[model samples]
Target: MAPSIQSLSMIHDSQECIKPIPAFSCCYLLRSCVRHASLYIGSTPDPARRLAQHNGDRYGAAKRTLRENLRPWEMVAIVSGFTSRVAALQFEWAWQNTKVSRHADLDGNATQELGVRICPRTAKEVKRVAKPRTSLTNILANLHLLLRSPYFSKWPIEVRFFSADVHRVWQVWLQRVDGLLNDGIRVVTDFAPDGISEVEGKELLAGAGRVGTLDVGYNSIKEYVEKSQFLLEDGERINCGVCKQRLILQHDIIAVCSHSSCHCAAHLSCLSSHFLKDKDSDSELVPREGTCPTCYSKLEWLTMMKEISLRLRGQAEVNRLFGRRQRAGTPKGQGLKSVRGRGHSEDENESDALQVSTGLDTVNLPPCSDGPWTIDCAIGVLGGIAHRPGGVSSGNDSDATVTPEIETHPQRCRRNQNTRTQRLGLQKSAMINLSDWYDAEVIE
Candidate 1:
């Protein structure tokens, strides 16, 4: 039987339930900001005591906005299975400070991290704060890391992924996942292989907290290629600097080189130059067992120069491939032809020749009307102002300045430029969300 809220005071008298908490241990707390509807993440050694303090409104801290909102069930525990308490604490702190929670959806759409399994508490019970055991700590650590990601920023309230096996769901969900991204919804969760990394997870989480719009999702270079207009010829080709082979540009083999320096084809023979150069005076080039010469930086100066040329050529090819896609009518995924099937080679020439409408075809602009504040009126006013003489408008021009000597301030101009650059930076980042492209219709 579950304990009732009324029994909390009596339960404190009992000694069997509570245990001593370890010092400097790690655990996390996520409080919902009532007014702003945003989430504030935190962590500490004693979750039970810390939560009781918040609910009791002990010090009345401003950041603790959920004092009155804590229900009996909201005092749930987050369990992690770390090998040590220190590791748990480190994971918790890193999670709160960075992309772990924010990018949860992209990390894998794990919703459990944001979970609040509230339980009744009493002041007496709170005095002895209970620390989670190892199993619980590890679980919590996983949850925290998974939740902090760009994709999971907009996670629906109260959802989390809990098992490693859940990752298989993604393989089956590929189509649905792509649709979500195309519709401007990015989901992140820690169960994802990439999302588990401490470095990437924290980076994404910090990004999401700063901007509510950052959505986390599983992303890869393959996704980029498939979604863009870069073409591949053969799937087997490798993109190593020395390889000069024709390849079907599939997701795995898109890096094969068409450059001049290390123009080896993608095959066992492609790595010969690298091996032959690196071999000792007595060593000969052995088939199927050679490392790269240029990239390894192990060969002679002349060979390095040759490798450098190959690298440059590789970069140029990459630029050209992407450039061609831009000129083509298709956006990202619609431009590239993965297999040789329809029409021509589906190269840039084909893409350029075709006409395509961008996704913003449905934007509705209000019609022009007979209003004093019309855009035309504004343009006409600007023209008249520019037509005025340098000193001041001669004869009763109400808009004319009295002083022609009021020169533009260089400092002010510089400040304005800086402001513009910052705004531009923000706008560019916002565009990555792709929110503007998505449209939902009213069923009614």
Candidate 2:
């Protein structure tokens, strides 16, 4: 006999419970056990499984790694915290093509080494140039350059070294580099992927110690999310600590204080602006971390962003913590799209719909704003200080001179260009009204 509707629903729920959540994308460095100099770089959602694949112990090995000489392969390091597989893939491509990639720091003169001589060389000259061999040091240097590049610097990427020797080399490079990496980027050594003890994870979460392993960090984030769920449920009305505006849980992207006892909560953009107040606003669109407006406790921007991403994907654990039930007819992995389509009007542009579906539409401004800020307005406000005509001082110093050196800094110019491009992209795609785009869905 055919199953009843209730039975089918139970079956569906059981399958959903057991369905594995998508893992975070990571880019890994692999070295042949037989030949240490032979290396490969790739990105995958499952690092352990991918390592096995490369070692020929599993099916689906890459053609280059399937050779008998490189029988066994070991992962030297893995870079995690990429938001999507596409982002990880882009990083992998950039790493693989550093000499030609715009993200790399290779000098224009260096391009001649690949065979572009004065007045242009022939094809034979290019072939005779003999491509330079990629060394471990060169790989590490490129990795450092890519992390500091404007394209990937804003991401909360982490580099985890599984090999002691490689980790040591990474440290040596860090000491030799001209500038320090952003505080948000983590460099972990001797990282254990197997998991950590619960007691140790709790200690790390409590600020008594730092997370030394991947599992411990994941557990700490999970515990923090559980705590946030309780706080969100307890409050009848939550307001942004920075902007003093009401926050709608399902509709608005919000960030909570990392301190367990601290009840500070704020809109994502408002909190980002608050943290960037002391920073070079013109050069940076995102802040690495900041003190909580209410608690004055330090918070990591990466941790907050991870929590929001998890919520957007509607992970099973997040749903359980928030006491949310998936509707019977809703398909898997479309939770974000369903939530976005709730209050969207039919007349909205396709670009706006696409932006809303990506879960970034609410990032531009607070919900209570009368009108969305245009790209030009955002640029002016974020620029911090406005210069008068003819380079005159806006301050009381009538004789103050403007330094051409500071105005013409290459790094500063590149940063300003990147920031403006990002703002323009957001303004063009996400100018819809938040109030009309999302309706508060009461959770019982």
Candidate 3:
């Protein structure tokens, strides 16, 4: 027979019924900030002892909570399954410093690294911290390196690929994977056969704690190649792709490879020279369009150059390939297409592009807005400023002048930037509940 409710409760809540916990490890979140479940992330091996440490009758509370004067913090989340203490420490560090960590999502989304966004209504979302702009080629190179890093396998994280549109993000990544396999890019580069390392497995992607990367490939070339992969706009970097030498001069009409699957930018004229040098078969009908030295995609000179001339000539092409904002009257799945049909050959130029266009059309792009201010980075210049060094409020106020040198610290500059952004009050909208990233599905 089932035990009575009173008897069951008594046994379950008894001290003897509690299981023993390990020592020397584990990070837990203490939810004490709210009246119900306040949130604070921390790590300790012995949760029982840690709880006692936070609210001990003797000794003192941790410095983080000493100011709050809140007692009896309850442990709500416990992260386990780390092989070593260093790994746990690494996780704690990333969680605390989410903005700088590669594992954190700073997409101006209302998500938290800890998996649960704090108080749904009261939590102040953090704004994105800016970094210097970089060339897409350089960025992709670095991303490729990190993807193959041993840390990607050992560390607990997820790598999410984003496009301007979420559905397209998945499509672009899959296409990249296929291109690498079918085009033999895997033979030259360190890309894995399946595209992910085996050892890292689930921990690397590690569920909701995914690290987001971009399909920054298509969007960031020097010039936008609209409507036609046939024609390319002027690119920023041009070295002899074959010799890796600087082009003799600036006005070289480069002959770039015309493979839509691979946008390998090279000195076009240099490529033709290399093709002829290789003793590749040459004729008027089938000119030597030798393989691209970089991506190894087969190239035919006639198709590479001819396909382009037939496609574009100085077009704005805005709102052409870009997904549109979804309107209320639109039908569901109205703009979807298969990735296979989307791949157009030189023969199917206009028609194939039309098919690709269907899937590319999106309804609503996430709105552009400001990010939440990082409070730690907030400038406290006016708070009790009278006694700060060099500030002579106590002396003659009229004679005081604060030079720019006073705010030279990199840390202070960050604080000032954050403060300035906070004063501006620009912010984006949310796709899902920041409160529970694990359970919430963001559909827009």
Candidate 4:
């Protein structure tokens, strides 16, 4: 017997005179691109709508997963249509469990609920939806896009299968990142500021790999600056000079010392170091257990360091670039009367075109190179040194051969001088002629 038209349709028609809430069954396929897994689950009544809702941020109990990492179109294996909603829900719960769900009991949901993910339309599909290149710049750009995405902004992404597991991972990564910044330690790979790059994403994954619970101590964060290296030391608590009770801000100028009898605000770094010896000897500690010796309160070193360091570095880069552009605008033959004030001669014009900026003064860019250096700057002196692997003999400023030593080998010195002169070019001088110039702008 042919099935009724109402039973076969994707959407329900209320006027069809079908049995109330007619039950149907179907199977849906979900593949996780991030984890590279296949999930087969069943659903009831209207599978299409249910699948769509699960993928979207709005409808599914899986909304937490959807908001943070999953995208709607990523679900690759969906074959819906089930005999009943209860049966469908049961299948969904079973599929979700193929992994782990630590918080399953609290939500009153099945342990094995289906999570949304992305995948190719079929196993045979070879093309990738996103480009494979993962350079630092591209990763940062992608993070910026994610930050502005509607999904990320809507809800707190529940990445934790169990509350304790996820929270613990996040807390540790945050601590390491904070500690480095506070100590003025800059990891070149982490060149971009926090929140601006995908460091959060990378750290989240990295933290998960590290197996251990955090052992944090609440104390003042102390550092010893020795020979340009900053080392972390133990924290101590002292009294505030003004308030006269206990204080934690060890360095703040409270106008008085922690001890009421001696109103001096200073405390020996050595004295504080001794006080912290009672705590754990581990190099890293949690900021909370750490206290401001002067204020006797929790030390929030990480939050402050991340914010301050990122801002300062960001501002420095901008200022350095700005200075470069300003210097580049200077005309090519300013002081050279032979080239400019002398006459508007053809030879002078040709000489001007050959001139290029030696980007030595630009601090933001990498040291310039003859060919390897992207910026046309003087920092390329480093490149000239490489040309002669034999190494140049050095001397004083009158005959300073660029290198920091005094030696003979006048011919080598001459060669070095020529390289420097050529690299310097006419970038700093006034224009010999307008015709000699070619347009150049700083890369945005």
Top-TM-score structure, candidate number: 2
Off by over 4 Å in 4: 1-110, 113-284, 288-291, 294-299, 307-326, 332-444
Model 1 misplaced regions, further than 4 Å = 1-29, 32-68, 71-208, 211-245, 249-252, 256-444
- After superposition, the stretches of candidate 3 with alpha carbons farther than 4 Å from their true spots are 1-24, 33-38, 58-60, 67-69, 105-444
Weakest lDDT window of 10 consecutive positions for candidate 3: 354-363
CA lDDT of each candidate? 0.32, 0.58, 0.36, 0.28
Once all C-alphas are superposed, what RMSD does model 1 give against the true structure? 26.2
Residue 29's C-alpha lDDT in candidate 2?
Answer: 85
Q: Residue-wise lDDT of candidate 4 within 124-153, one digit each (tens)?
A: 212333332211112222222222233222
TM-score attained by model 1 = 0.20
Q: What local lDDT score does residue 90 receive in model 1, on the 0 to 100 scale?
A: 54
> What tens digits encode model 2's per-residue C-alpha lDDT throughout 68-146?
8875767778888876667898999998888788987676223333342111111112233322333565577678888
Candidate 2 yields a Cα-based lDDT of 0.58
Error of 3 at 22 (Å): 8.5
What count of clashes does model 3 give? 19
- The number of the candidate with the highest lDDT is 2
Model 1 Cα shift for residue 281 (angstroms): 28
Model 1, 85-168: lDDT tens per residue? Answer: 555655455555444444344344332333321112210112332232212222343443443433332222122232222223
lDDT of 2 at 339: 29
TM-score for each model: 0.20, 0.54, 0.22, 0.18
